[model samples]
Target: MRKLISESFFFCSFFSLFAAFSPMTIHAAVKVPVQQMGNKTVATAIGATRCLTPAMKSLHAQTVKQMEKDMAQVDAVVYAKAIETYQKKLSMIWSAMSEPYCGYGSRGMTAVKSSFNKSVNRMRAEFLAVTKTAPVAKK
Candidate 1:
């Protein structure tokens, strides 16, 4: 009985040491909460969005690329018309590269429009996933 107890105690001590020294699990912090993301979508999307007359083909390409990423974050249809107006400003600028211009400035702007849809859809999916998950899973 004495030998058996000592053996069990030794095993328990080894197990405890191993467990204490094991690699820890880490969790990443969420950047935005689901509840707040919807509110920020439009604001963040258009934050840096603007159009400038094409200085050169390269500059025009870069500016428009950044602006599209910004504008594609709108979450509602009410703002879509405003986006359309901003985008419309581009049409007048291209003919005169030296002239500064304003707006999203596209005739069709299909790519920005598509990215906007993609962002909204992805947000919806993420929100849905969070809503469907277990409310109280222990760490």
Candidate 2:
């Protein structure tokens, strides 16, 4: 009996240690459709634009132009493939963020709106800082 108890204790300890060290995976609370996520992203971007100052908007345009130029340097096919992958990853992120309120109704929608506003505010601050210190292109 004592031997059996010792073996059981050892097994429990080993299992507990293994579990403690195991990697944890996080999952989204709800599964949002890709189409819905896309729509939400577009709406969010449009709403966010309203919060940007004129200078920030100009900076954003310049940044986008520079990015497009940089992308153009890459092979067309390769850039297209990369963009596809990027879009897929972005969609996944948006879906995850939208998961919580997927079908919850008005309260869930309110939560989503609150979350998007918070995210937009954070992004706006970051963009403002970037625009303020970004270097001007030499003619």
Candidate 3:
């Protein structure tokens, strides 16, 4: 019984030490607000050269590509109207991204990427709905 108790204690201690030093634990402790992170990402992407990071640059390129793909699936008129509406919503997110935060590190870039992905997804959904209901053009 004593040996079993000692083994259990050692197991617990090992796990406790591992958890304490884990990257996820450290990240959780220093968690920044999503809005702040995203703002830093956007600011870095569009801001002056000094503020830009490679991560933000990559994210900006990915976002542009995704937006273009989303816009390509619909008719020209539908694409134009949908893009206008999508841009309006994206502008609000861009405004949110203007807030101050930590530099555009991995976490901040991830948040920005997430926001862009969500925006694209919403735009795609809207385009699909509009196309489905729009009158078919007789070629």
Clashing pairs in 3: 39-97
lDDT of 3 by residue, 32-76 (tens): 433256447322332332223566556656756765676676666
**TM-scores for every candidate against the unseen true structure:** 0.29, 0.27, 0.41
Q: After superposition, how far is residue 46 of candidate 3 from its true place, in Å?
A: 17
- Per-model CA lDDT versus the true structure: 0.48, 0.48, 0.62
lDDT of 2 at 126: 47
Q: Candidate 1: which stretches are off by over 4 Å?
A: 1-55, 98-139
Candidate 2 runs further than 4 Å off: 1-93, 98-106, 136-139
Clashing residue pairs, backbone N/CA/C < 3 A, model 1: 45-70, 86-104, 87-104, 87-105, 87-106, 90-105
Task: Supply the global lDDT for candidate 1.
Answer: 0.48
Candidate ranking under TM-score, highest first, comes to: 3, 1, 2
lDDT of 2 by residue, 1-139 (tens): 9999999999999998887666551224334333356447432321122223354345445544644554455555534645454345434434544343333345644554455445444544443444345355579
Cα lDDT tens digits, model 1, 40-122, are 74323322333322334555565466547656655335345445544555433443333233223564344434433454445
